[model samples]
Target: MARYILDHSTRPDPLLAELAAETAAATGESAEMQISADQGTFLTMVTQLVAPRVAVEVGTFTGYSSVCIARGLSGGTLHCFDVSEEWTSIARRYWHKAGLADRVTLTLGPAQDTLSAFDQPIDLAFLDADKPGYPAYYELLVGKLRPGGLLMVDNTLWTGHVADPDRHDASTVRMREFNDLVAEDPRVTVVILPLADGLTMIRKNPDLS
Candidate 1:
């Protein structure tokens, strides 16, 4: 079923394919951190629809997701924040190769510090960073997200353990807490899609913005 879903979805282009291949060969086990092709396609579609002037991505691993988002921009910039210079260097190369260097910006540092300093009203944001930092990132992103802005969070399902009553592992527990936090927040509407682990979409209410 998963394979069928992917087969039907829009495929990644050559540049994206090369990025995936290089990520796996170079990063080895860490390549699992990169978003899947379907997710990348989804990001592109959402960005196109939103047509945001300022988009933000937290936890850009190897830049697959960023590339997807940047490709969808008409006149917007995608701001990527990550702690690893090594991983993002590869991403930077791909961005340049895809001719999207002008539409994307990279910031290397702790997202807590870098994101707090970002003053632009975010029209869209993607969070796939450390699980423990979700709450902090959520606060900062939601605070800066303009009214009706969209925020997408990845890997919130933790292999579906978040819904399992018997799963007591630390990561599973932590993910559950984060899910609950988003669900309970009154400022945004939340929906968790069971695509690629779990993708949660949060849209800030325009009235409250």
Candidate 2:
């Protein structure tokens, strides 16, 4: 199914393909952390649609996903938060190579601290961080998100283990709990898409008083 979708979807451009190649060669197994080509395509499409003025991404991972989001911005800025200077240094090079240096900013630190310091109203956000930190990141992201703003969360399904009763792992349990929390929260409406791993689309209620 994933193969079929990737086959049908618009493919990444040459520059993006180059970044993917470098990431793979340089990072080895860690390159798997980069968003898949299809997922990157989706991020670009969503960003174009939302046209957010203030975009935030919590996990940069060598800049594949950040590149996708930054490419979609018409005139907005993307603020990326991550804890790895080593990896993000590569991302910086790519962002410069992609001519996106002007539109993107980076802060290297624990996202829990960096994100909490961000005061601007988020028009859109992408969360892909340590699983244990999702709850905290969600709160900060949603709290700063303008009513009706959108937040996309990656890996909420834990490779479909969240639904398999027989597969009880710590990560799966935490993801299930987080999904439940999002589903029950009245402030936002959410739906989990079976994208790579899983992508959860959450929108803060526009009708909130």
Candidate 3:
């Protein structure tokens, strides 16, 4: 651990702001990408219980979500894939300050290539990458995740765009398609939660493993 691991509660912890400050300073960007308190809590709870040894995060942004996942798992490594060195560098600094830098591996490049290169089985994964990439990410992750592994995706609701047939933005359209695909994906058990944005959590059935 390189820095303090902020305690995660049902509500947002005050320390989250302090961590965000470090991330913001490093990236020179606003904290718009940070996960909301509710979503953070959900991620923390899942990680703590699942205790995944190998976790993967797509679309790390400034690393807010990665930090949350790291704090939840008592002792496991999170491999974060993102294309922004500027932002991930900021995330790395905060992770170092939080004493969690050692537990997190930041990989810079296209997420698909990085994920495809992963040879080890993944125990848990968080997807918050490009919207159109969701279905592909899911297809890749489902095979990589071991039995009982958890896959939690952020922004599945796309700010309620899926319900509106009128919004035909590329991202929204892709999300709608992915939503339908996941619903029919019999290989895993899925649940959609209306947390900040929206999170679609899937637990891969044991048979798939």
Off by over 4 Å in 3: 1-9, 21-31
Off by over 4 Å in 1: none
RMSD of each: 1.0, 0.9, 5.3
- Residues 1-209 of candidate 2 have per-residue lDDT tens digits of 87899999999999899989999998999888888899999999999999999999999989999999999999999999999998899899989999999999999999999998998999999999888999999999999999899999999888899999998778889999999999999999899999998999999999645
lDDT of 3 at 167: 99
Cα error, candidate 3, residue 180 (Å): 0.9
**Which regions of candidate 2 fall more than 4 Å away from where they truly are?**
none
Clashing pairs in 3: 1-99, 2-99, 2-100, 3-97, 3-98, 3-99, 4-98
**Each model's total of backbone clashes:** 0, 0, 7
Residues 132-157, model 3: lDDT tens digits = 78888899999899988989998888
How well does candidate 2 match the true structure in TM-score terms?
A: 0.97
